[model samples]
Target: MTDFIKKLEKEFDTQIIRSNKHIWENYYDVDNDGNITTLYLDEIDLRDIDILLPIAHSLVNLAVLDCNIRTLITLKSFTRLEVLSLRQNNLYGSPLEHLSYLKKLKKLDLRGTNLTDTSSLGTLNSLEMLFIGGNDHLDEIKGLEDLKSLYHLDVSNSCINSIENICANENIRILNLKGTNLKKITHLEKFPNLESLNLDGTLVEKIEGLETSKNLKELFISTWRIKRIEGLENLTKLEVLDLYLNEISKIEGLDNLTNLKWLSLNSNKIAKVENLENLTNLELLLLEANEPITYFDTAFFHNLVSECYIYMRDMIDIEEIQAAAPKNVKINYDDDYRWPTSLYRAPREVFE
Candidate 1:
């Protein structure tokens, strides 16, 4: 055995396997005092690490760190970290001051950390994805204007009322502000590359200020107080739209979205399914949990092409509608077989 391997075993107080038998075996090293440190560790699983041990500062190549602990004071030295997850930690009162020096960070997950202020994260210019959701007390994110390279940002279930700080980032594509106190949104024209936006469970009463986001493809505004479906005629590139659990009594302003594929207006006050004949690309239409439909429009069913799935309430006469509908359009009334209740359900590839 080499003298360096002996010293590592003595420092880490563990047996040393010097041979590079596995791909991951060569990246880890143990110190003489049972402290693991490595220069080649790209991803570190700190979930099972002893909290008493000093954080490994020597892992210069560490790219990912999964540390969901009570405090992250020791992680300030990980200057080369690209992805740092402090999810579900008991953090409080702006603990991100410790991570202000990590300039190369691209992804940071602080979900469920109970963080109050995130002013310290604005300096991370290279961040691409940031997940700060589930921090119920986090009301402000005013310092995120400098993140010019950000792409995806999720602040769901936070107390934020406005998103004016990061709206100017043209590189951002997906923005999630669900379960927030947002009432109005402006400066959407600055995000010319934004494709997917989520405002579910927010307090937004109007759907204006999005006339310039023509690049938007997927939009979710479920469980809000929006009564009308106007102000969306400019989104010709939209493919998936979810307005479930709203106060919409009629369906309108969707004729421009010729590329719409998946649309959900479930749990609303809609009584008619009109204005959908122009949606030639629609495949899945969800209208479940709405007022009972006493009037049947067979022409509406004929507008949908073959293999289209329409999910509605069980009270609708399926046999009568099927007799008049096209042979290929599948009308489903089974509540159990319908799409998942949540509009923001993860993509199907997550389980596969």
Candidate 2:
């Protein structure tokens, strides 16, 4: 390691001299030239931020999570930082414009912070993925239109009431609005490149405004007020569809979803499983907790899961459903498993 890193470690060694604290080497990632590339410190009360000035010039990723940090003025020295995560901090009154100097930053994760303003984000022109979820005080986001290159945006579990300002992010590919104040789904045509959309834990009743999301692949809307399955005829590229814990009665309007791979409709009011014979690519099907479902299309299971696997965890009537399932289809069960979006899905490939 370089002398600067040695001095940096020495300072950290003196600062956190307790036996329970780890050394500075364990909290940083170094390159071949002995330059610290990434530094991660969690749950450590960072009273002095100047201790990290030694490696700031070479650091590319920095995470000071849950450290009770109250300012961002010291991070301006990390000129090469590309990814920064200040999750679970107390930056309620910090100056967000100080981060605009990070010209190389691409992804910024600020989840579970007390930030209330985002008007200075427009200056970070290189940002591609912005995560500001779990900020209950952040009711609105500004400068979304200035983020021309932004493709992934997550504002779940916030106090935002409308999407009028969000409609300007025309390049967003994956938009997550779960557990927000959105009452209805609208302006979907504004995002022609949207792929994955989540509206779980909202008050949306009707499944409209999605006629133009033709390239959408994964859609999640659970535990809401949807009663019927409609407005899904144009999504030919759809692969995974989850609509659990709703009030859906009958299964219909799914003729164009021939490429569907996974379908989840648990805890609904459906009486029969029909109209799924065309989903030949389906590998996993979930129909648990639907108390009214009595009839199961044997032909659909014979053609769909006969050559694949399925998850039958906590199924309503496992014995009967297993009896009706094909013998070649393997059924796996889990007692306490939940979907990734139960809270909010991180920015990753949902299918894999």
Candidate 3:
């Protein structure tokens, strides 16, 4: 190593030793040519990044998570950086203007920051995965169509109410909008290649506007006020569905999902275990906490193509389940909680 790099290494080691952190070598990686390749300083309070500016050209992956960073001007020098994470920092007010200089940057994680604007990110054409969730002040995203190479994007738990800006990015594959202010979903036809979508903790009352997600395999709509399982007729390729903690009273609108493998309807208002006879390819089924549905239709077990796991509660009859279930099917009563407190009720027992 050169004298300058040797002196820089000594200073970095002293800082880590004084703070009682792990060995300095563990936080950074160097190439055989004495160039720094990776640096992980997550949760560290080091604020001065200019001290390492000499090796910016060699650094490829860098993470300074929760480091109280307030600026991004120094990071513009890292021209060779491909992945950068400044998650959970104090960065605010369009501080990402310098990031557009990183032409090679592909992935960025800016979660839980105090940013007010992110319009500058539209210039990152090479970006593939971008995470900007948990910024309450960020309400709108601009210039999404400019990111032709972008695929995975996350803006969950923010103030975003509309996604009109990203209606042109056809390459997007996975999108997460969980816990946002969105009450309805539109422009889904723009993402014909989407595979997974998370709308949990939103204000959407019904399942609609998903007619074009034909390739979707996984869908999550938990912890919301969705009343019925409709608008899923076009998702014939769906394999996993999680509707936990909703107001669904019936298990309809799933007949087209013949490829479903894992399904969870726990904590809903379901009153009947019907309409699932078509899901013969299911490998795991969860139906716990629906106290109203006191019985299981034994006919549903006969359609299983292979062994399946069924999550049940104590209120259901164990004798009926054991007799109705096929030899390969398995029953699970691991909900661990009893329902309807009564003085004459006896202690609970597990049936193997």
Candidate 4:
């Protein structure tokens, strides 16, 4: 470590030439080598390449800055960087022009940044996890036509009313769109590897085109206007389905989701739960704030014993439920027996 630090300092001195009061914003002593291993400055403006020119070949792994007035970043040559977070700053013209050089980047959080015209971002082929959730008015982000290595994308709060830009990224596993208004989505047939999707807040009237995915696991749509569950039967690998705060009265549409382990329907108009029988793998059912529960048959939900949550307003059907309940089933609204999400999944032995 000590020898490496000396090498880093010697490399830094030969590369960077300070300017504008020589105000070093920050520095790090990786191995106490009487020299700075990492350096940061305020006036290292990206508008000119002088600041970025020196650090590109140095051993810095992360670079984060705010070009409060700059229109672009001067980081076309920094290829070895691992992480970069440049958010909430202004990039009037565009900063993602030469981003393709960052092929080794793993996580890039660009939330709240004005990347409105970042048509250049489509070239960052190595970006694995990206967060553009805060750019609420970005109607379209063209050019990401070949980012096959991207895995996680968080566009939750963005105005990305469309998914047309990143449709072919087969490697994307997680997608979060928690607070965007999406009336309809097309071309989901290309996302075969998507695992988790969060559409919690939006006006999605229906989910008609999600059959192509084979490995989807978790889905969150708690605060949407959707009334029914559709386009999910083909996802035999689905495990968690959170549909809280909707108007779905009955579980009539989930007969084929036998692999689901956790299902929540709290704050809905549901009264009859007879349709829950086919969800044999289900262990948790959150039904609080629902209407009259006279149609609930314990036999239908008896298979959920190892972990379950069936709460509503009414007397307990302990006798009828006990007879059909699985021996491992445990229920509790008042105390310690309540099961966690981790326990909602049936054990390996149970599945065996």
lDDT ranking, best first = 2, 3, 1, 4
TM-score of candidate 4 to 2 decimals? 0.72
Clashes of each: 7, 0, 0, 5
lDDT of 3 by residue, 118-195 (tens): 667888888988888898987876667779998888888898776554443788887878888887878788888998
Instruction: Flag clash pairs in model 4.
Output: 122-143, 122-144, 136-159, 305-328, 305-329
TM-score of each: 0.76, 0.85, 0.84, 0.72
lDDT of 2 by residue, 1-352 (tens): 3565456557545232212223442366677776777666667666545667878888887777787788788878887988888888988878888898899988898888887878788888888888888998988887768788889888888887776656346888988888898887887888899999998887788888888899999898884599999999999999888888799989898888998887888777877778887888887677666665566666777666346555544345767777877767666555575533232345552111
What are the per-residue Cα lDDT tens digits for candidate 4 across 190-238?
6778888877776676766777767889877766466777777787888
In candidate 1, position 186 carries an lDDT of 77
Q: Which stretches of candidate 4 lie over 4 Å from their true place?
A: 1-79, 165-168, 301-306, 309-327, 335-352
Model 2, CA-based lDDT: 0.76
Measured on C-alpha atoms, candidate 4 has an lDDT of 0.62
Task: Show where candidate 3 strays beyond 4 Å.
Answer: 1-26, 32-35, 165-168, 335-352
